[model samples]
Target: MSTIFLAVGLVLVVEGLAYALAPSFIRRMAEELPKLADEYLRIFGVAALAVGVGLVYLAQHL
Candidate 1:
């Protein structure tokens, strides 16, 4: 569906911008990611997922 494509495109744009604008910061995060505790990463990922779902819900309703 068009909505799915739009979501993917928007994600790519945002991700690309981050890499383009701050390649060093991105690399640093990637390098440190493996050193982070698994539980901490899992919690952060779930929180991000919740925020993403909230944004999608708002976009649809508002």
Candidate 2:
């Protein structure tokens, strides 16, 4: 339980830093997302989904 909480807390801290310090970068990325080719976009989406799933699995295991 403590491990899970630590994992979630770490994720939140990193995300919060991004939100606080790189809002423009995030916005730019979002704006540019649609300009990516369909295949590349699909690949990026899949990779992100996989990473997210892996993180959740690790958190659970921890």
Candidate 3:
């Protein structure tokens, strides 16, 4: 659907902007990620997923 494509495009745009504007920060995050614990990363992933789902739900209903 067009909505799906738009969402993907927006995500890519934001990701690109981060790398473009803060290349050093992005590299630092990538370097630090390998040192992060698996459990911590898992929790972060879950939190991000929850936030994303909540946003989509609100976008559709509101």
| Best candidate, TM-score | 1
Per-candidate TM-scores read: 0.97, 0.60, 0.94
In the order shown, the candidates' Cα RMSDs to the true structure are 0.4, 3.8, 0.7
Positional deviation of 39 in candidate 1, in angstroms? Answer: 0.3
Candidate 1 lDDT by residue in tens digits, 1-62: 99999999999999999999999999999999999999999999999999999999999999
Q: What is the lDDT of residue 7 in candidate 2?
A: 74
Query: Highest lDDT, which number?
Result: 1
CA lDDT, every model vs. true structure: 0.99, 0.90, 0.97
Worst 10 residues of 1 by lDDT: 27-36
The regions of model 2 sitting more than 4 angstroms off are 1-16
Per-residue error for 13 in candidate 3, Å, reads: 1.0
State, as a TM-score between 0 and 1, how close model 1 is to the true structure: 0.97
Which model is ahead, 1 or 2, in terms of lDDT? 1
- Winner on lDDT between 1 and 3 is 1
